[model samples]
Target: MKLVKEVIARFPADAAILDPFSGTATTTLTAAERGNSALSFDINPFLIWLGNVKCRSYSVEHLACIQDDARLAIGRVPSLIKNDNWVPPLFNIERWWSAGTLQVLAALRAGLVEVFGEPTEDRTDGLAWVAFCRLVIETSAAAFNHVSMSFSSETTHHEVEHVTYLYLAILDAVLASGSAQLQGTGEVVEVDARAIPKMGRRFSLVVTSPPYPNRISYIRELRPYMYWMKFLKEAREAGEMDWKAIGGTWGIATSRLNEWGPNSKVLPEILTDTVGRIAESGGKNAPLMATYVHKYFYDMHLHLSSLPNVLEPGAELHYIVGNSSFFGNMVDTPAILAASMQMLGYSNTVSKIIRKRNCNKALFEYDVSASWPG
Candidate 1:
């Protein structure tokens, strides 16, 4: 938020913000908090739901009822355990939780279903936010210290008393965030960044962290949540979801890449050069990784080329992107994006080193700033 706020403040205070790759909606939420209209888009429905949950308005009475509803939901978990061993429809589900913890989380899922019923676009998200927090923050063994989530060293965390206490704590925090005085509304759409709608909507700023060229697939981190929330009903759906997302190369998607050729005529040669280096490196998964890198930049180019049509003249754009490494070869993602923007008619391009990422000493996140010509 500090980064997003800083960039947004540079533009006109009344400037509406656009985040084409609004993953967690950090930019949109920050903009809305500051009374700036925020329009965000994502290919992942779960992320879209999450962004909406963070920015939507909540009534005081509704917040109170959510707390009561959550308590009622959690209390019903004991009888609803269904032998305390059922797992989600996810494949290799044990990798996410130990038996005891999985059982408790499963019961909580059933409880949420009973209490919240089916989720609709206009439904109250307070309890759903609680369940989201519980799943990601409390029960899941997933860790995000690295570039992607890793499942290791996750001890079984169970006990109805502890679950109850944590649920209450999370509910309070959710209610608190929902209680903020929002002067602007956040509109989150489940759509691809590559094809943002030209719905007569023109934004003054484009603040987003488009997925880095790094091979980390966002879907890998989201499978646990999507399955529990019923966005995904089968395991194969994960790979299918990733395939639709730009730069996605997870299950089934990886194999699908083998059949993919570059969008050669439109993309610059630098991308192919990088892919060639990675493919010829003899590194593990080199071929697939190479294709992943090519597809990422190719998709980004398609997205960049469309920006001028939607943004207001002279609108500033800030992309928080990161460099990636395949084997020992470093891919300067910011540089590639800056060049792409230049070709697409954006000017005043600058790539500044923002922070040294802790994941790898050589990897750094860059503030790639540019402006669409007036």
Candidate 2:
């Protein structure tokens, strides 16, 4: 948030800000609160719903009524999961939550559907749903502090109090935060980053943190929320979305391994060298890793190439990215992105290491800053 403020300070108060990969809407919310017109896009439907809810204007009284309705509905509904009932297939529920806990969750889920109906673009149902999602994690056996989803060694149990009161409390907090007076207009859309040029609006600034080249599967991480919200119905749908995402590991098939090919001519030499070395290492997963790395940079090349069409002359761009090491080969993502931006005719390109991560010696986050020629 501080970085976004610092970068936005360089432009006029009315300057438009764009975040292509607006993960949780941090950049969009920051820009809107500062009285700047902001636009955000994400391919993930769940993320888009989250971002839209965060950006929307909500009434405290209306939200309070919704909270009351939810509480009442939860009391009336019974805890029941039939054999034909739908549940997220990401993991076994018994492993993560006690039977009693799942029963309460099922009741809450049914109550939410009965009370709130499906989420629509016009109402606060999306906010209510997000609050439920929060409750899921807070009451589950998963370690909430970890960066990734991790189940406790022992199953965690929850009482009715945990589901009812906790959800109401979380909903109240969400309402309190959403009641803030927004200074500027914020718009969020579901679209691919490469399709920005088609919007036909030149932005004055761009602030985004794209998915790192690491093997982390964001789609997998979001599976629970997506499934619960009905954004994704099956594993095949999840794999399709992951395949279109910028950085993905689990969805790439072996037959399509050769499709990623070599590095693009516009990228830095280090990227090509790193990919070549990884492919030649003869490790079990080396080829897959190499393809993933190559596909990431290649996708970025296509995305950066289109930025000029939607950026105002002299507009600034700040990309928060991280370097990664796969199979002991370093992928200097920031440097390669800087090179790609320069190749796309962006001038005054610069890459700076913002902070070093403790998890890996080779991992370092960077800010790749550049300007479109006026």
Best by TM-score: 2
Lowest summed lDDT across 10 adjacent residues in model 2 is found at 77-86
> Which pairs of residues have clashing backbones in candidate 2?
none
* Model 1 Cα lDDT, one tens digit per residue, 1-374: 67888887776667889999888888898898888899999878778878888888778888888888888888898887766444568776676777777777767767877888755456765455545545544666667765556777756766767666677777787787788877877878986777766778899899988888876888887777777777778878888988878878778988998898855456666766787899999999888888888888988998988776688988988899888889898888988888888878889999998998855458898999998886
What lDDT does candidate 1 reach at residue 340?
83
- The digit string of per-residue lDDT tens for model 2 on 1-374 reads 77888998777879999998989999999888888999988888888888888987667677678777877767765544444445566557677667777777777777787788866566665777888888877776776432466778887777777678888888888877888878887878987886455667879899999999886878867777787788888778877788778886545433355675644465767678888988887777887778888888888888887777778888888999998887677788988888888777888988888888756476788899999985
**Residue 365 in model 2: shift from native, Å?**
0.8
Give the Å shift of residue 167 in candidate 2.
Answer: 1.0
Clashing pairs in 1: none
Give candidate 2's whole-model lDDT. Answer: 0.79
Q: Poorest 10 consecutive residues of model 1 by lDDT?
A: 126-135
